[model samples]
Target: MRLPPTFYPALHDRVRIALDRAGLDALLLDDPLDVAYLTGFAHFPNERPVAAWVPRDGEVLLLVPDLEREYALDQRAAARLVVYPEFPGERGPFTVLADAVAGAVRRVGHAPSTSTGRVAALAAAFPGVEPVTSDLVGRLRLRKTPEEITLHTEAARIADAMLAEGARLVAAATGPDDLPTETELAGHVTRFGTAMMYAEHDDVVVVPMLTGGLVYGGANSAQPHRLPTADRLRRGEPFMLSLGCAVGGRFVESERTFLLGEPTAEQRRYYQVVREAQETGTEALRPGVRCVDANRTCLDVIRRAGLARFLRHRQGHGIGLGFHEPPWVADGDETVLEPGMVLSSEPGLYVPGHAGYRISDTVLVTAAGPRRLTGYPRDLDDIVIGA
Candidate 1:
């Protein structure tokens, strides 16, 4: 996984700028994506603690556990590699990191999500070092580089594949071999998505955010976030799915409502409303557009249709290194859209006793217009199967 040639150097410069602007000498990063954004090392620290130190004017130091040494070295994101032993090593991991940072530490900023012990260690190491929380990492990563954009675009392809398979499985309801139980089909989608992802980028190890998909039908479809159940698919009802696939450690959302058989007139009406709402959200996406407007556009259509109550949650979310990021498209979020910012355009509706419908497309905001990277059609007719 080779990072762009200028990625590291440019990021270091930005780090210095962020540090200077914050009136801090250095920023310590513990969040995996924060570190990856700067140094290209995307190791999930989990229980094993890892810290990447970015001094205002020196080489970056990565204090990582011994287990991640090989992977860390592969990325070459850090200058001084401080490899500490496992948890029960001669010295505590935090202490070792403190000793390293204390050498030339002053006022420093850190990830707010850092563990309490780690934050305390840093505070103790540099007693005079004023501690402060800064979302500089997230802010800096908000606008993606070209490499990042390519990674996200590719990830969206996997989502498209997953959606395609879901449509196929549901469309072939009558064929026993083609039809799979809700749980079984969810598993198949995961396996198939995994296989397809590996095929696209064999060498790159992509950690999928989640394996099992949300497969619900009949009464369960009424629940917005319900997962797959053992109940089999039934004709004349909506088969909804929220599937996923990842590439380059990035993910995108591809959610669509499926109709396994001929749908009822009511179902068609609801589907059309939701699909139009989703389009409104996507069409509203562009550089310089307000996130609030984008979100409102999605709901406004439903509101006009007198189904606004069924429109739950925000319209969408920012997509990048993680599935969900900043600048959510919802009420009161005055964030302005910018070129290269990828966001999901998901708008849905549900009635507890009736079926539900939603369509999510991972959209890329561009100067010209919004590009829907996840290319599955959202039209009610397109999604209708087994007619």
Candidate 2:
């Protein structure tokens, strides 16, 4: 996805700022998302050893595989593109990457410890070069830019459209003794929602997750995935749908629970608790507030509702290029919320014999307050699929 014109410049400024704070001459970014964030080129990192070397001054250098030279050049106008052929025997992309890093600065900061092998190889090649850990580079990317917020807002709009279509399909399919299989219903929703996003042709849709019934409840209780099954929708069963979509490498996440039929008293109470907890968490989002307070707010709501034991996970997490990012909304995280920070407020409750209800939405921290990107209704009354 091609980023907005302001994105790369803002990213460059952020990198320079980070470099100054970390006392590094330059930073070597090898991760695909990091490279795209800095250089505005999005491609599979595994295809080539692509790296972005950003100096405290001067233009950034994008070292890419020979095959992707043209594509990289077309995508990134600000960065000087350097191409290297396939690695020869005993010589890997690290050689070219090291040369690129050496050309940028004397001391280089590596992104993650996983890049240690590449860092060691570069140090071996350039005996005098120093490699330092600079995770702060990623920390700098935790907050979004105005342009990023726009892109993410567009992504959220697409997600909201998907939810609307899914809801309509569910309502239409529901009738007296006219239940559909989980796979069938999920396939319809996924096809429609994915098509709506892909029609824009600006961003690709990740795998859509739709699961239903007791099996789905168990799977969601364990973890989230996209493997919907053939379980037929029945009366009083709960189904959960989670979605993640990206635009220009920026991601938005949303999830909602739906009841197949009229919920029982216990189920209604549980859903109310989950919804209230989510509301509490979302309301707590604002600039300068501690991230952990959001989690505490939601947990406190759940605990007061007498379902604390069913709460199995933290309130939410940071949302950006990746679905799950840093600066978690959990206890002990003292990171103050900033105006551009985006987060998901997903507080869930799962009981062994009862049901699971989770509500999630991507929220952007704004000067006024937290603005929810997804517009689907969060009320329990609106959560029922059909009568």
Candidate 3:
């Protein structure tokens, strides 16, 4: 799922338009992800600073340490390579970067994530130029391009396979003593998903570092953010598995709560309510719908069950290059859902000392309607293990 070389050129054209509208003569970017997004150059981000300089009417420049010069050129990045000695050298990288853009830009722009020291350095570079905050790149990333959607779809497939494998592992336990501990289950599931990703994709440079899962069983499942522990899963209890993977920098998640053994009326009731709420919230995501309204739709379902008191979080949030981004599906957010926007649909209920039930999927808002990118079953029969 490697983006074609032409992708950056088109992205550059879009940035130029954005720069014109922002009245910025140039954009000074030091964040690794932002640099990678615009220049098609992904590197090991560390304390050693790497930056991308894009001027309104000229070629892009990349400031890097001498060590990364060959690597940057090897990637065939669509930018002019500008190398410095190293970080904190006799002359710092920022000093060198300032020299590169000294006379070219008058009103320089930076992202909100930029450090205050970095902004100050840019201001000192040239007395005539002023540095100001700008969200030109962040705004451009809210909507997914067709190619990005393809990568997210592929990531979703891997997430689905991992979840199915996890269910099979739980089903293999013939008795309570045969069950695996939470840490063991989480580790094995993550390794299996990472292996599957490597076997399927030949375009990856590094290992799939973002493929992993968290397993919480029994009482621990009652906490929405609980980490995997050494507790063994017991029959007649609930276990929650949250799994995700990334492909081409795009991410997708698939999560489910499973009942280890046959029915307890309360367990069945909680699972059904959560599943219904998830479906309702996912369907409510349509073009022109406000983010708050989508969240309210899920809350309405939980309220009907008289379980609103157990609600611990919002319905979902945006997903893409980053795991969580803007246009959050929560209260006080008035962002309107539009075509090409992708979000996570998770409606959950957590009751301390009892159990928790939740189901999550990555969904895409399309012109026709909402499309579920992760195609794992949500039915109660399909999720119950070793029943």
| Candidate number with greatest lDDT | 3
Q: Who is ahead in lDDT, 1 or 3? A: 3
lDDT (tens digit, per residue) of candidate 3 on 148-195: 898899999999999999889989877778898999899989999889
Query: TM-score of predicted model 1?
Result: 0.93
lDDT of 3: 0.86
Native-vs-model 2 lDDT? Answer: 0.74
lDDT for each candidate structure: 0.79, 0.74, 0.86
In candidate 2, list every pair of residues with a backbone clash: none
lDDT at residue 245 of model 1 (Cα atoms): 57
- Count backbone clashes in candidate 3: 0
Candidate 2 lDDT for residue 319:
83
Tell me the TM-score of model 2.
0.89
Tens-place lDDT per residue, model 1, 297-320, is 888999999997886688999988
Q: Which parts of model 2 are misplaced by more than 4 Å?
A: 88-90, 100-104, 174-180, 200-226
lDDT tens digits, residues 62-86, model 2? 8777888887766654588877788
Q: Work out the TM-score per prediction.
A: 0.93, 0.89, 0.95
Worst 10 residues of 3 by lDDT: 201-210
Q: Between which residue pairs do clashes occur in model 3?
A: none
- Best-to-worst lDDT order: 3, 1, 2
